[model samples]
Target chain A: MKQDGLTIPGLLVASLVGLILVAALLDGRGAHATPGEERLFLPDAKYLKPMLIGFHGVAADLLWIRTVQYVGTHVETDRKFPQLAKALNLATSLDPHFLEPYRFGGLYLLYLARQPQAAVSLLEKGAAANPGRWELPHDLGRYYYLEAHDYARSREWWERAATLPGRPDYLPRFVARLYAETDHRETALELWSEIYRTAQNDSVRSLALQEIERLKAGSSEGPLGL
Target chain B: MTVAAIALNTFREAVRDRILYAILIFALVMLAGSTILVTISVGGEVKIIKDLGLACISIFGTLIAIFLGIGLVSKEIERRTLYTIITKPIHRYQFILGKYLGLVLTLLVNVAVMALGLLGLAYLWEGVSSVRLFLAVLFIFLELMLVTALALLFSAFSSPTLSAIFTLSLFVAGHLSGDLRLFAARFGGAVTKLSAETLYFLLPNLSRLNFKDQAVHGFGVDGGSMGLSFLYAIFHIAALVLAAMAIFERRDFK
Candidate 1:
């Protein structure tokens, strides 16, 4: 009887330790994996809205964070952001007043994803949804000026951005310069250089470098390049 | 005096429930996990933490309210404890009110603990305490009280299983009532519009009681609206509790 009691206790302890080790190994495997590889499929915002049960803002916040992770993971390997725009779209749709996803998502779509048209559409939606905010219109203007090379649209957006409250001081100056149409190549070079200097990732830096090089070669080719 | 005694006893009973502690522990764990969640967000880390933390408290707190509230009367009846209580020198309405108060009190304690954990986490993140976050939590507590009243109303008339289902349906419907109103205005034709409008007015407008968006964004919530929401919650809760009392008074004990 004494030996049997000791045997039971020993078996219980061994099983407990064995279970903990297995759990730790599983946890370590999950922790070591890249966050991007674990993509979450979110349902449509219309269907999701009612199910959120008044936690829509919290859901939006989580989706926005997931979009950031998607960008961080894909920006390195595939240089493809298939889900980034969709995630941002869903997040903003759930909470239309959320401003960050529109601004930053627009930048990522434009520069890294090379979806300039989609970027413009997203920024336009953001501008309409958030009329009082200056950042959306300001970003729209920047995309037009730098990427699309559509000076007329850029000037129009910049003028609108300038009229809004909290716009940076440089916006009005850019609007004026765009209207004057003076030193276009120099301005493009300066914008690309700034983006290159402030870029947080290798993809953005390389894109900026390519733009700078293109601008430099064009400038060397004189007014015909402009 | 009798009602107070029953209320206190019910509160003690609720405190000892293992499910309450289980939900409370899960809520606290999720609130603590907000710290890890914030590290992944590029900007608005503080907002993410506060938003998720408040959501965890509200969601888990509602589950506790519904689960416990539904069992308040039925569990007593099932254990033959209701006979002893009804045979006492107490009215059935008093018993119902006592049960409701006890659950509300229990919810108050749990929500306060969760709120403090969230606020402590928020302070650690941004180094400042937010009055708006607290106000949001207060409204969430009121919402939970309303849900508890709902559970009690169903419990007085039905089985605990059915009561849980009814309370949860109402919770979903209450939150969606605003959208229902909008749908009526936009798409419904004559009879459907009238029916939708009538249901909208009859149902609880939970969206009015939700201050999470205003709290997270630091937007100024108008004082008049806040007062109106508080009054709405009070009137709705009172109506539900009175209805429960009326049903309990007519319920067959034999």
Candidate 2:
């Protein structure tokens, strides 16, 4: 009887210790990796599509927010943005009409990731998906002119944007100036300044500031010298 | 009079169900939570709220419909209460229709509460509400009505658990039926294509009823399509309910 009593308490103590040890091990494993590590493995949009059960828009919103957070977290590190494009792709694919991810994700790809081709592809996809929205084409024009220096393509995109309703008043002026091929540096400076002022976050603002400084230094060197 | 009495009784019984209230509370919380969620977004805050809110109503309303609906006939039969109702002068079809209507009425009330919460939140955030949002809600209600009909149909012949599974699978399949046709056209062999095409035509094309995208983006849904979608939903519900009645009529109490 005494042995049985002792065995029960002993078994209870052993179970408690085992649970504590298991929890500690799990917590330690979780703490070893950054939280962002877990989000690195996002499933393809095709797999998630059926599971969303018509909540694709909400899924897009949440994924876009996750992309934003991922960028903010990794922007100060290697600035690799390894999953940024994929996250944005998934979000946009889930709801093709969602415009913010396309525009902002394009910018992030262009400036942060230094993948202008990827950025152009994303903006082009956005343009194709949302022909009525002028912003995608407008952003494409800015990207080609500012990042790629593809003046001809930039001019074409700006002209397209000019025809779209709700495009900014300045797009026509930009298109006409592009036709003239005059004051590229000044135009870039003005665009970057506008971006700096309207930037939503510190990282985007700092990126715009860097471009503004580069444009200013280039102008100081000489006309078309740098 | 008999159908009305059974419907009213079913409605009274369903309204008192804690599961209905629980699902409603979760939905309302999610709708309210969308406001908090929008604070983190840079732009399209109103769009985010509307999308999330509308999704919450549709998803939770469907859950309520399925959970309550699956139990409607089965619980009656399980408790032997259905024996009394069947032995009455009323037909079995009346009981099934009454139960279906009762659950749909419950869903209507719950969906209305969620929709109001969403509209109130959207107005608070954006200071404007569109008629398209309400149109989206109407389509969502139609979707829920069909889902309730599906649950009623499955519950007429199967256990509650199996009925819930069947209803849930049909709900998923309904949404994906459009994609199934696309897949058939793209990748399916002749036999597979024929089968996929047949299933696609037979299954409800729920994507046709989705107006959340247009509603969120402030696009107008054409009148003809809206009328067609409504008619489609009504026809599907009528077909499913009629099938359920046919099954229930043939069921033997002995």
Candidate 3:
């Protein structure tokens, strides 16, 4: 039998089915309750702490997103940092090995949230679990130097970061400058330049390079010129 | 016995198709490429890998299910091989079931290889094997099985082009049935609600089979939930196959 041409009714039926399917898939709301919010507790709360610690990585991811979302735009204030710190503490405590909440939670708590103390605490947890990783300690040093402005603490953390395997070559110089003091600004600019040049990821390199340029433009006649 | 032979032959034929290999290779490359992409991600690198891996598995696996499954019976008919097979003592349902099973075997092998690759890559990154990942992959296989049934059902009564379109549409609807019910109840009028309900029942509800998000995050498997999902897939496949058998049994090929 010869195949019949495309019939109008057949086309309409197909169109209706297509429309129905599209309408179905376009609805993307998740389940009503957030996964791990109910289980949050402090380490001092021993009975509740045990339950909180057992929550899984997916719950940790959700809590991390929710915690950041909850912290909102007032992120730079000390008030916002504590709330975020509390949530991240809960999240990472639940799933200690989850890499994202550690990196992102620490960045938000330290840099954006302006709680360098809390950031240090969180990154310390990450470092303890993920021993030998250079990034976590490097972040710890960044928080101390840039946010806390404690040169001594910054030098200590940077020294630790430098000793870690897989650390960049210029980290040792940065750690040395923290103690030498004489050429610290010039060394920071140089270190940032190396960060830009040798960074593995483009975005990270871009951010580092931008910061170096900003520093240079600010202190044109300063150590940046040398 | 003849039906088993035909099914085995078709399975071998599908395995050898260059299109199948092309899709398989592409999916593997993307799954592995996710590792390199993870390094660039500022944070949530592991989540990114799992997200991309799971999405690739579903999309590529669905393509394999629909393309091969839609053509299984129609290709036989088109090539006039169905006439020879139909003239034998074998029943039409056996032929249909055998063809469906053959495609399913192909999908199982493809899904297993992809799942193992995803699991291995994830373990390499995390340094721990996730039992949840394997369970999530099993759910993906069940999802594909529902789609294979849909394709076979459509092919029983329609042209290959129509069969492919209908089956793909069914796959999409099944993925979103829960959301569709919500939309209908909340905003749609009476007619829309009824139509949505009808579709909800007629199409396989594949969203029920998705434990990927939960599993990917290393949340332990909910055994009861997985059992329910398996039952749902099996029931859907049974209904579709029965419908196809009924249609094929009545059709006059003379």
**Top model number, DockQ:** 2
Off by over 4 Å in 2: A1-39, A213-226, B186-194
Q: Tell me how large the interface RMSD of candidate 3 is.
A: 9.4
Candidate 2 lDDT over residue span B192-222, tens digit each: 9999999997898888899999889888789
Q: Looking at model 1 chain B, which ten-residue stretch has the lowest summed lDDT?
A: B38-47
Question: Residue-wise lDDT of candidate 3 within B68-157, one digit each (tens)?
Answer: 988887888889998998888888889888888888889999998998898888888889988787788888888888889889988888
Note the chain A TM-score of all models in turn. Answer: 0.77, 0.81, 0.57
Tens digits of per-residue lDDT, candidate 3, A90-116, equal 777666666666666665665456666
Give me the displacement of residue B208 in model 2, in angstroms.
1.9
Interface RMSD of each: 2.0, 1.4, 9.4
TM-score, prediction 1: 0.84
Cα misplacement distance, residue A73 of candidate 2 (Å): 1.1
lDDT of each: 0.87, 0.86, 0.74
Ranked by DockQ from best down, the candidates are 2, 1, 3
Model 3, A86: alpha-carbon shift in Å? 23
Model 1 clashing residue pairs (backbone): none
Model 2 lDDT tens row, A1-226: 9999999999999999999999999999987786446455578888888878788989899888777877877775557777777887888889888988988898888778877778888888889999998999889998878766788999999899889999888888888898888988888888888888888778788878877887777744321232
**lDDT, residue B233, candidate 1:** 97
